[model samples]
Target: MNARGYFWRTVQQQEVDYIEDADGIIKGYEIKWNPKLKLKAPKSFKEAYNTDVALINKDNFREFL
Candidate 1:
């Protein structure tokens, strides 16, 4: 694989599912199986990395693909 690395992060109970190093771009994801549940953005990640995190769920998983 050409990806640089697969990363995981956690700050208390908040977390990122993974940060995929695709080529040179770092993509962050948080996944929820239940679309109806509320999803909170990982603010610490944005503050530390200056990157936005994407959410994946049953309702909108196709877009992530």
Candidate 2:
């Protein structure tokens, strides 16, 4: 994943599991295979990006994937 700080900060030095572009567009996926698996989108994700995050977890894997 690619991330950049706002307010004229230099390029970020860490990698993330997700990424959002300058226009706040994000790109990625999450997959849960176990029948009892549970997952939630991160708060930072919604706070920093645009577009709804997609969840590909066990409860609705087929329909989502």
Candidate 3:
């Protein structure tokens, strides 16, 4: 089956770097270009949408990719 979905910057601008998906499954992603940089996800990200939210760092970015 084929699914379609999209993710956008919320009004709060949680600072999501990117999002990836193949079906209806929603995956929230945060990309940090800098290895030493720090990123944080907004609380509303998970509750606002019925999707999975994750923080993507240099260490585990492959999992999300």
TM values, all candidates: 0.70, 0.39, 0.57
For 1-65, candidate 3 gives per-residue lDDT tens digits of 56444565777665455655556566777677566765576667667666666666778877755
Best by lDDT: 1
Tens-digit lDDT string for candidate 2 (1-65): 55543321115432233433544545544455665645455555455544445556566867843
Please give the ranking of all candidate structures by TM-score, highest first, separated by commas.
1, 3, 2
Candidate 3's C-alpha runs over 4 A off are: 1-7, 34-39
Higher lDDT: candidate 2 or 3?
3
- Between the candidate structures 1 and 3, which one is better when assessed by TM-score? 1
- Say what the RMSD of model 2 is: 8.1
Q: How close is candidate 3 to the true structure, as a TM-score?
A: 0.57
Predictions in order: lDDT: 0.77, 0.47, 0.64
Report clash pairs, candidate 1.
none
Count backbone clashes in candidate 1. 0
Query: What lDDT score is found at residue 8 in candidate 2?
Result: 16
Among these predictions, the greatest TM-score belongs to: 1
